[model samples]
Target chain A: MTDVPSYLSPTGQEIVFLLLGVVAVGAALLVVTTRQLVHAALWLVVCLGALAGCYLVLTAEFVAWVQVLIYVGAVVVLLLFGIMLTRAPIGRAADLDSRNRPVAAVVATATAIVLVTVVIDGFRTAYAPLEPGGGSAREIGSSVFRTWVLPFEVLSVLLLAALVGAIVLSRTDIRGRR
Target chain B: MHVVYPAVVSALLFSIGVYGVLARRNTILVLMSVELMLNAVNLNLVVFDVWLRDRLHSGQVLTLFVIVIAAAEVGLGLAIILALYRNRATVDLDRLRALAEFPVPSPEDADDHLPENATEETAGQASRASAATGPTRPPGRDDTPEATP
Candidate 1:
C-alpha cells in the first residue's frame, strides 16, 4: 500500500482551490448574464460542477459527489423540465429590468465587503495547515452512523416530507370531490 | 490549505446568482439562479468542514440535505408553473402582474389574457432562435405528443 502523506502542503492546495474558485465564479456570472433560459441552466451546471471540484480539492470527497449528483444532475434536470412544461419564452423577456438595480447593487456590494472583512478577521489569529488522511469516506461514515445518528434520522424525515409535499403539489386533481 | 479559495468562489457564485434572481424575468431562469446560489453554499460548507478536520463530516451531511431539499423545491416549483400555464396559456412575468395582488380569477377568466393566436409560426421561430443559443429543445414544438404530460 502506498503510504499516505502526513500532511498536505498549503501552497499547492491553495493554488488549486484558487483556480477552481475563479472558474466557479466566472461560470456563475455567465449564468446570470445569459438571456436564454436554457443557456442559463447550462451555465448553472458549469458553475455547480466547478464548485464540486472545489469541494474535492478541499478533501471533502463525499460532499463533492453529492454536489454533482444533486445539483448538476438532478436539480438542473428538473429546472429544464420546468422550462419545457411552462413554455417560458426562450428569448429574453421584456420585464428583466427592475426599477431598483442601483439600490440592489449597492446592497450586494456592501454585503460582500462586510462578509470579506468578517471572514478575514475571524481567521487572522489562527492558522491551521491542512491535515492529511482525516476526511476519508470510512471515517465520515462511522462518525455519521455513531455520533450523529439523531441528526441523520431527522434529515431522513425531512427528505420524506419534501417528497410528499412535491407529490401533493404536482397532483392535477387536488379537489377529489369534483 | 486555506478554505479561502472555496469561500471566495462560493461567494462570487452566490453574488452572481443573486443578480440573476433579481434580474431575470423568466421563471425557469430564476430557478436556475437559485441552484447556482445553493451550489455556492455547498462549496463553502465542504471547504470549511475539510479545513476543520472534524470527524463528523458535518459539511457532507449538510450538502446531502441541501440536495434533497433542492430537488423537492424544483419539483414543487415546476408543478406550480405548469398549473399557472394551463390556466393562463403564457408564462411571461410581465403578464403575471396581477399575481402580486393575490386576486382570484376563474380559469375561464384567465383565458382572456392569453395571446389570441397560439400560432405554430411564432413558436417555430422562437424555437429556431433558441436552438441556436439555448441548451434544451423548445417547449411547444415537440413532435412526440404522446410523451409525458
Candidate 2:
C-alpha cells in the first residue's frame, strides 16, 4: 500500500490508457447523441474499438481481442443489418430523441457524478502495475476449461437457446401450437 | 496505472448508456445503448482482473462470458425488432406504445376526456397523451387484415 506510485507523475501505461479512455468516452457520447442512425452505429464501433484498446493497455490481451471480434466486428454488423432492414433513414432526421431528453440528461449526469465520486474516493490510492501474459490466450483458455468450465458450458447452452429463439421469432411460418 | 482512470471511464460510459436508453426513440438505438452499458461492465471486469491477479482469473473469464451473452442478446433483440417492423411498419419507440398503462380511449370516451370549451392548446395536449397510450385494439384485429393481403 505504501509503495503505490504517485498520480502526479504518471507512467507511460497510464498516459496511453487515459488517451484511450478519452476516445472511448467521446465516441460513446457520440453514439448516443448522433441523429443519424447509421452514424450512431459507426460511432459505437469507434467506442468499442477504443475500449478494446483500453483492455489491451490493462494487460487483458485475450479480452481485448474478444472484444474486438464480438463487439466491433459481429455486433456492429448485426446492428447495421437491422438499420437497413428497418428502413431507417440513411441520413440524419430530427426525431432521433424522445420528449424526455432533458430528464434523461439530468438522470444520466447524476448517475455519472455519483459513480465517479464513489470510485475516485474509494480507489484514490489504489494502483496496479500492468504485467504482460496474465491475460494471454493460453492462460485464459486454460482457466476457462479448468476453473470456469461449468459456467462456460452453461453459456454455450444459453447461446444455443438464443439462436433457436431468434429463429422462431423471425420466421413468420413458425406458429405456436394451440 | 491508477485504478480510478478505467473505473471513471466505465462509469461515464454506463451513464451515457443510461441516457441513450432513456432518450433514444428507436429500438435499435436503445439496443446499442445496452451494448455500451455491457461494454462498460466488461471494462470494469478486465481492470479488476488485472489488478487483483486472481489465481483463476475469474474477472477476465467472466468478461468473456459477458461478451458472449451480449452477442446472443443482440441477435434476439434484432429478431424481435425485425418482427415488430414487419407487423407495425415502424420501429419508433414512441409510436410502439401498445402496452402503455393508459389505453387509448374509445370514440365516445374521447369527448369525455376533453372539456366542452376545449381550445387548440388543450386539444393538442389531449391528443398527445392519447398518442402516447396508443389504441388498445385487439392485436390480431389490426394486423390480420393487412397480413392477409
Instruction: At residue B92, give the lDDT of candidate 2.
Output: 78
| Decoy 2 TM-score against native | 0.88
Native A-B interface contacts kept, per candidate: 0.54, 0.92
Off by over 4 Å in 1: A1-10, A91-99, A125-128, A176-178, B92-149
- B-chain TM-score for every candidate: 0.66, 0.71
Off by more than 4 A, model 2: B100-142, B145-149
Q: Report the TM-score for the A-chain of model 2.
A: 0.98
The two-chain DockQ for each candidate, comma-separated, is 0.28, 0.64
TM-score quality measure for candidate 1:
0.75
lDDT of every predicted structure (CA atoms): 0.66, 0.87
Error of 1 at A108 (Å): 2.4
Candidate 2 residue pairs that clash: none
